[model samples]
Target: MKKMLYFFLLILVALGLAAGVGMWKVHRLADSPLLIRDETIFTLKPGTGRLALGEQLYNEKIINRPRVFQWLLKIEPGLSHFKAGTYRLTPDMSVRAMMTLLASGKEAQFPLRLVEGMRVSDWLEQLRAAPYIKHTLKDDSYRTLASALGLTGPEQVEGWFYPDTWLYTANTTDVALMKRAHQRMVKAVDAVWKDRMDNLPYKDQQQLVTMASIIEKETAVAGERDLVSSVFINRLRIGMRLQTDPTVIYGMGEHYRGNITRKDLETPTPYNTYVIDGLPPGAIAIPSPASLDAAAHPAKSNWLYFVADGKGGHTFSTNLNDHNKAVRSYIQVLKDKDAQ
Candidate 1:
């Protein structure tokens, strides 16, 4: 009986020792961080089983062993509740920490800046090169957004979206980003529209925006914006055509190539202020806040015409004959400079 009891005690000691060793190994494995070299993108497919996820991690070398990951999920089933989305995984993450991140489904984001005055085609090209953008902008999406914004006719989504830098995760949808950009623009327009000066010639905020957009395309010199605004306002008050060069350029369309030609001015298009009697059908480009402000409250001036001097500044004229002389002088100066 004594020998049997001793043997039983020895067996119990060995079993406890084995159990302790196993536990120690598991604890070490759990604490160890998996070393990864390159950046990896992990995607959790819809309804992917826990075992499959474990296997994927093992194959990608994100985890040392599949069984350990599987065991973790089995013990804590709640860890399998990770949402389906794209995640940027670092190689330096520990098995336990990685699992926790996967369950949270939070991903790193890259920011892209959309500057004002960019065309829709330019915007689309930018989004295509962006990381994790996944989907392309459909034709219908632009139409849908335009319709919602109360814009009609053949303009499409050209100048409607407001330009701003936005943060987006790799898993962000294209539609979501576009919608966000539109919302930002709408808010900006509304804020500026509310602060506009009363008794302006424009029928509403939209018309003001349209005029501001034209001024934005004409020049980037902030000091000259109010002056330019005055020129347009003066023309409007006198029932004269705007005759802005940017409008002619817009009318030329693909034929514009780069520089505006005399023929472009003579040609007639809806946007060609050289031929049209009033404001263009729509905005030529996206305007900045300062341009919008200048449009809202123009500097009270009688200037009706402006010609760019060889210098960065422009020479303003109060009458047509003065404008003609200034143009001639500017041309002569440019020629003399070129000859020299």
Candidate 2:
């Protein structure tokens, strides 16, 4: 009986040693390099099962053996804590590290770069097509975003959201992202407002913004902004009509299919600077910081007229006669070149 009891104890000890060795092997496998070097992007859709995920990883060469990975999970039990989402896994990361990464559920962020001078409609189209962002703007997303941003009276949120690159998680809400963009614009406007030229003809910062929007639309060349601002400022100072073509186009409303016609300029509307004799009521489009600066600190010049020289730039003139002469010269030059 003593010998039998001693034999039973020895078997129990041997089994315990075997279990310990098995667990150690599993731990080493979990932390091995095989799980680290796979360069595949794993998108774990909602309701993906752990067993399926393990098998997929094995098939993708992320793991050498699916059975071993599954056995490790059963042994640890904590490996099932891994959550679902998009994960970019490196080829060389250990299985343990990958498990930890997924379990934490942290995702990589993609940047959304909203450039200055983009209209709201333009941005909306871009957002709809963005790969990292998931949104369906079929309903009141725009209106909801505008209202959340405290923008008033505009059916569309154009010219309101400030342009800047923003980083967001993959699952970020559209409204939240838009609100952040709008807040950035508001902060930018506030920061620049106090530094604006004092005692300008405009009543408030809003008017300055309105004028800046016009300047933004006029030209994209960096050096020409101040010159263009001077033309508009001179017109404002002398009480002459702005006579800007863009304002006319804006006034022509949604039916403006293409190009401004002579009749369109003559057709009076509130936004038609040729007839309105002052700044327009609101911004036509969002302006860049350079345009805002140009509007704030206009060049000290008597230039009141400008015309496109057809060389991707404009020629400036100080008076109507000079402007007409420049216009004729530009036209004649183009014609002469064309004739050659």
Q: Give the TM-scores of the predictions, in the order they appear.
A: 0.80, 0.78
Most accurate candidate by lDDT: 2
Scored by lDDT, model 1 comes in at 0.77
Task: State the RMSD for candidate 2.
Answer: 4.3
| Model 2 residue 80 lDDT score | 73
Our tally of clashes for model 1 stands at 0
Model 1 alpha-carbon miss at residue 66, Å: 2.0
Candidate 1 residue lDDT tens string, 147-221: 554556436355556777888987677667877876776787788778877667787666787788887877778
Off-target runs (Cα >4 Å) in candidate 1 are 1-22, 74-78, 128-131, 134-156, 169-173, 307-340
The digit string of per-residue lDDT tens for model 2 on 189-264 reads 7777778776567887677778888998899889999899989988888899899888887778686998987888
Please count the clashing residue pairs in each candidate, in the order shown. 0, 6
